[model samples]
Target: MRNVILYVNLTLDGHLAGPAGELDWMLFDPEMNIALSGEMRSRVDTILTGRAFHHGIEENFRAQASDPASPAELVDFATWMISTPQVVFSRSLAEVAAPHRLAGEDLAAEVAALKALPGKDMVLFGGVSIVQQFVRAGLVDEYWIKLYPTAIGAGQPLFTEQRTRLELVDSKAWASGILTLRYRPAR
Candidate 1:
């Protein structure tokens, strides 16, 4: 059985995005990138993100495709982004551009079923709102957070309405002041 992990970067204030839906505050250090690379390469295999993040990917692809010489670099990133199968959950979105399969069903049940597939762990890179759903469902087995040094006092929050406890597994300080944390549900 595969585990579901949330390997996403967040701010000290626990907001993955700013009020304007920007990640301008995340310092994006090499250590964090290295960890992400490790996760992509060896750790969790699948990449899961919400509709908002999917929109971001689409916009990035459009921007990258505009430059003719960029496809080489872009195709590489795209290959990595879609390297493992991806599941995007959206009620409003009918179709995605490429390499993304629709969940096409209930969120919790779909993800739970997906976890039963052959894999190490399913990486959940959420849009906070989507993460809340996973958390509420009690389906996430592990939590991996790249906590940035800076904090935005007010913005979107990482966790949501259904309050739950998480027990700290371990915490490491990256070279660039980001904190790599692992947590399991308190229960």
Candidate 2:
């Protein structure tokens, strides 16, 4: 079975986004980009994300893949983002474009079915509510959090109401002050 990894970027204060859903505070450099791409390439084959992020960030990444002016490394990363299959969970969205499918009602069941399929692994990129659902359901197999140096005091918190104990599996510190922490649900 494939693993479901929650890969996200968080502020030092644990906010996924700013008060107004702004992600401008998250730092991204060439090294960080390369590191992220390497991890994604090695671990994930499918991406699970909320509809909001699919429409907002994912679309932008897809566009960046085809842009001639985009940096080479970013373009390569965008290619990976666009090529990977994605399942977008949304109650209101009826349809989505190619490379992405609108998931059914039962999130856990759908995730389970996906895990049963032959694949490298799946990753869930957060938009708050979806991450909360997965956390509450205890569906996530691993957590890959990239912690930024800045703090957004008033914003969407990553943990929310769910409380799950995680055992640290690995950690890496980047020169850009972004810390990558990998964890798994405590057995």
Candidate 3:
């Protein structure tokens, strides 16, 4: 079965997006970006995201990703996101782009069906609200957190106030001083 992995960058203080949704503290070194992009390309067959982060990721490709490597990787990531099957969770908009909405109904069952198919891993980006829904539903399989060296008191948190415990499967420290912590929801 395809696994659901969250490849996100967070501060040492554990915030995904800072107050006002600022992500300036995110680590974006070319080396690590390429490495993570390669890894993500190899793993994800589909991406599910919240609309909020989708715009930011899209904007990066337009303005900040000027470097050849960065833009190239961004192109690949964008292409993958656009071309590959995508299911977006939105409560407001009607429809936007490819693959259409995977909103409503039993998302966990839908995710499981996608996983059961022969493919790479299924990934969820942005949309922490939806992510929390999945996490609370006991659907998430793995969490790959790239902990950057920074601290923010207020911002978007990773996990919501869940009643269950999650098991830490593994973790590794990168040369950039970022820690990649791997977590699996306890069964």
> What are the RMSDs of all candidates, in order?
3.0, 1.4, 2.9
Model 3 residue 16 distance off true place after TM-score fit, in angstroms? 1.3
Residue 117 in model 3: shift from native, Å? 3.6
Kindly indicate the candidate among 2 and 3 with the higher lDDT: 2
Model 1, CA-based lDDT: 0.76
| Runs in model 1 lying further than 4 Å from the true structure | 58-78
State the lDDT of candidate 3 residue by residue for 51-140, as single tens digits. Answer: 665655555544544446655667666555556666676777677665545455567767777778898887887766776777677777
RMSD (CA, angstroms), candidate 1: 3.0
TM-score list, all predictions = 0.83, 0.93, 0.81
**Candidate 3: regions farther than 4 A off:** 57-71
**Per-residue accuracy of model 2 over 110-179 as CA lDDT, tens digit each:** 9888988997989898688898789889999999999999987789888877677999999989999999
Candidate with the greatest lDDT versus the true structure:
2
lDDT (Cα, tens digit) per residue for candidate 1, span 101-179: 7776688779768877887777887777788778878878888888989888777777777787999998988889988
Clashing pairs in 2: none
Give Cα distance to truth, residue 15, candidate 2, Å: 0.9
Clashing pairs for predicted structure model 3, backbone only: none
Give each model's clash number: 0, 0, 0
